[model samples]
Target: MSSIIHILQTQGGEIWSALGQHISISLISLFIAAIIAIPLAIVLMTHKRIAEVILQITSILQTIPSLALLGILIPMVGIGTVPAIIALVVYAVMPIFQNTYSGLTTIDPDLDEAAEAFGLSRAKKLVKFQIPLAMPMIISGIRIAMVMIIGTATLAALIGAGGLGTYILLGIETNNNALLLIGAILSAVLTLIFSALIKAISKLSLRKMGILFATLIVLFGGFAGYRSIVKPPVNVTIAGKMGSEPEILINMYKELIEEDHPNMKVSLKPNFGGTTFLYKALQSGSIDIYPEFTGTVLQALVKTNQKVSHNPEKTYQVARKLMKKDANMEYLAPMKYQNGYDLAVTQSFAKKYNLKTISDLKKVEHRLHAGFDPDFYQQNDGFPGVKKAYGLDIASAKTMEPSIRYKAIANGKVNLVDGYTTDPEVKEYNLVVLKDDKNHFPPYQGAPLMTEKFAMAHPEVKKTLDKLAGKISESDMQKMNYLVTVKHEKSSKVARDYLEDKGLLK
Candidate 1:
């Protein structure tokens, strides 16, 4: 509890910023959902069949898995707040629409007749009678949607939409319980606050409620417009894939770039997402640069069936050449460390299975339950490559998040998991990594990757980043990962210390 308080005390500014983002996005999405759902619900009253159809569609939208929906939307709408809001709106619309429609349609027929007998027009009846009578049901729906939006909005962080989930994801990746607790508790608190606020608003006069909602909408719109117009133009935006390593690397990039050009504004988006998300963001010009691995370039992005070379220089050369030719991206010289993929097991499990090599896994293939990240499970150079190279096909493989896999194996939830060579958890968990005797996995030396166009335009930036080439070694990275993951140090501080230690920073 003291540790959590300390983190809150030290990082209070970041926590507030993230909390503001969480509230902004959630309210914006809920507002939009209400705007669409409420009027449509009112209009559908006379057309019962059409109303049913629309409600069924909302139900279908509600049933679609959130992550899967976000995955589908990324390619179309791109990432960040737009896609996150669209996904939330999709989830939010159903309850609001269903409740509003049900409440309006199911109003006592006697009251409707009374309104008609009083010479009330349709609009007047809705305004003075139907809507007021149905207000409670509508407010209940809004409360439900508001709570759901607050909870679902955390996923916005996955797509670079800033929110409290940043702390949650950071906590999970670095194994920091304090950060995790902060994010979770804050999120829960926000939900309760919004739910109660909606309930309180429900007690207000209709005119007051209208004034309040209108004020909120104007405020939200003005806030969004102000952010876009008021902020300094970002000259460089560097992003990184999920993990402590990427976070450290991007911090290093941001620090170096700013040091080189004092007047330049550089932005860092750490733990943005997986390689594909970052790559697409780069292609769309949403981000300027990110750390890329040589082997991932060859296998995942370029998808070349070229001969896999074990030599670090050879692999980096191939990656650099093809990346420019095929993907229109520049691959800088890689650092000395090879953060390659490897299969790991507990020390006890390895001893029991007598596992010494990738080929050894074949002996216990049927008995093994493999936990691999979604990227590794799907990439040709990951599980599929392992199967083809070693003729070992383990049927019981499950897709797991990168951070959770370490805990999963440690707790005996699974006997095997895929991990990077430089990951500190390999040492912390006392896990033994099997040798890839067949050399199926290629060397994954980290390099600064950016669009060729960006590289051409920002030669100074490229030069600044090139200083990292051949800088970080295997032990250097492992130790840095250890410092962040095990010691719970800030990535920015860790990165700065490394740069100072190596005399890389000006």
Candidate 2:
């Protein structure tokens, strides 16, 4: 129960912000879709063959899965709002298109004849009679499209599009039901409000021309103002990771710039995933900067087959060389801490077996229960790699979220679990971190990966990040992780506080 409240208090603002972004993306896409679809509908009414072909084409687009469409668009349009908007618009087109065509075609021919009898031209009949009569159906179609787009907008959070989807994804990732419920409710309410507005607009008589014109003007003006106010500078695009670490880094940078260098305008584009995702974002230029581990970049790009070294400087140098030669990227200065993977066991279980290291576990391997994250089970550096390096195979293994693995081990659900060396829970739970006698895992030296172009353009930014390099020891990293992941503190606030303590921010 306390945990629920903690999640809400910490994540509420993000949930609200995500909701706002989701609504913005959905409505903008719906509006654009209406503009294009309405015209296409009118054209189809007049030209039967073209309308048939177009409707079929749009239907096919509708069949494409939303996430798949977004993925396809990433290479062509890159990430963030543009690709999200495009995918939403494509998804929305068919409904509005079908309804507009139906509404126009279903209108009585006698009404057109009556208009002609009154000396109205074809254009006059379309504008004054056919369009007005078909509006209710068109509006209904729009309402449906808006709801669908709102729901799918949550997926945009995956690509750092910043919408209500952020809450849903975070909730799922952290297993927070309250956050999920709140996000879902907010999306539904927003959809209802938009649908009601559209319905009211459809019901309004054409005689209220002044009111209608004023409303349209106000909406357009509001949108223009919003675009100007929210749009970050054209010069700098800030991209980072989605979780606590990225959030902390983003907040630190924002505060430092705002307080000390207000002249520079920046935008934050956060992508949430494991190290591989952030690395790819940097490599593709979808992100300007992101926090990464030197070992990950080295292994992923340089030599997946090579053994990992504990020497942070050597790892950084190797990663730096690979980035320049292979990825056209740069490895920024390392952080003070190491976030390397650790093999953990509950204190009671560790004491009973007198287990303390990978070698100590060898005798008890067949009797011990193990837990691994799903990705860890599959990755080359995960369980299979551990087994190969240590020659210790546990009696049972279950895959779960990394955050929960510690708790499961603490509670005796599992005797052994994979954990980050610096996780605060190691201290909290009094668990034993078995020494890596064979050094299976590499030194996960925390750092930032940046494009050569960004490095050249913003040398000061590089310098600012470099100052923190090798400053965060493993214990410091673990405490910071605990503050955000376990304590439920806002990542941004925590990051800002840390930077201020270090005199990194004015």
Candidate 3:
């Protein structure tokens, strides 16, 4: 109870932002889906036979898994709101389409005869009679779509479109049940409220509904106008990938910049898609700063496998030098910790098999069910490299969301799962991190990657980041992660506590 209270108190700001995003994304997507679905359903209904074929096409879209759809969308559209909105719109089409078709076709033929007798045109008949008669069913469809969209909007955070899912993902990564509960409960509540609001709106008469629609358009237009005319509050925007250590480091930067300057208007954007997404965003100047690892930048960005240094400090120096020389970003001074990837198994699994290292897994490779983060499959030095280096052949390794991977391993869904050395769940779940005895993976020294122009523009912020250099050791990071992931504390609170303890913040 106390833990839950602390989380609410600590993460109140985040909850509010997520709620706004949740509402905006769901509403916008629903609005767009309605525009597409209504006309398509009208056309299909007129053709009769085409309705079944088109509905089936939409059914196929509805059948695609949300994660799979997002995976396809991310690569093609690039990550962020556009892909997420498009996915939601796709999800919503079936409900709206099916309902609108049902409504239009099932309408009384007598009304069409009466309209024809009055010499009314097709458009006038639809506006005056057909649509009005079908109002209840169409509204029901919209209500259902809105409800579904609200729930699905949470998944948008996975692809860097911030929504309520941000808290849930962070909660899962930290192993914090409190955080998870808060996100789940809040999402459910938001869904209910949105459903009720849509239902209430649907009950209004046609003229009233038109008024409501006009009002929404006006409000949205005004907001857009105001945003364009007025400057945004956030001056410096930095993002981080979805993980505990990344969360911690990003919060540390936020705390330092905000607390020191008191009114600097810094915006710390969390819940980036992945390393690849962040790298592209940094390169394209979509984001100004983010925490990235030496080895990840080496393998994912520069493909530095040929001359990658195995040593942590040397790797940081190498990555830093190259990033400055070759990329739009430059590496800041690194944190003290060297958080490399680990192949983890449940403690019981390790004890049962007496497995101590990656090489040991080769003996029982076929027996083990494997799971990893999807990003791992993309990196040159990730799962494939692990497979090649260890000479192990596991027929199928499922790629899952990083947050769920820990639970998946612990629950016996998978014998082996990917983990980071600094991950709190490793300790919290009693997972054994099998050693990379062959040194197949390179060193991953954690550091901030900032847009070089941004760094040059704000030397004060650079100096502030430099203060964090070599301050947090591996043990220190593990303890902080443990507090958030296992103990269910907010990362802000955890970071704040550590910084105060270290006398970095007062």
Q: RMSD for each model, in Å, please? A: 1.4, 5.2, 3.4
The residue-by-residue lDDT of candidate 2 on 1-506, one tens digit each, is 56557766766776666767877788778878988998889877989889999999999999998867876777677778898999999989999999999999999989878888999988888878898989878888898898888888888887778887776655544345666676777888988898888877777776674487568658967986998899766545556654455566666666655565567776666535555555656666787877777766765556545555678788778778877887778777787677777788887888899988988988998888888866467666678878887887779999876656766887778888887776677777888899988887877777777889889988877766666766766666566767876665656778877887877776
- Worst ten-residue run, lDDT, model 1? 71-80
Q: Report the lDDT tens digits of candidate 3 across residue range 310-424.
A: 8788888878887877775779988888888889888888898899999999888889788899778668779988888889898579988776888888788888888788887
Candidate 2 Cα outliers beyond 4 Å, as residue runs: 1-20, 46-52, 105-136, 170-181, 206-218, 225-236, 255-262, 271-277, 283-286, 302-307, 342-379, 382-419, 423-439, 503-506
Rank by TM-score (best first): 1, 3, 2
TM-score of each: 0.97, 0.77, 0.87
lDDT of each: 0.90, 0.75, 0.82
Ten residues in sequence with the least summed lDDT for candidate 3: 300-309
| Candidate 1 local lDDT, residue 446 | 92
Q: What tens digits encode model 1's per-residue C-alpha lDDT throughout 179-275?
A: 9899999999999998888889989988998899889878888987999999888899889888899999999999999999999998888888888
Number of the top-ranking candidate, with TM-score as the measure: 1
Q: Candidate 2, residue 150: CA error in Å?
A: 1.4
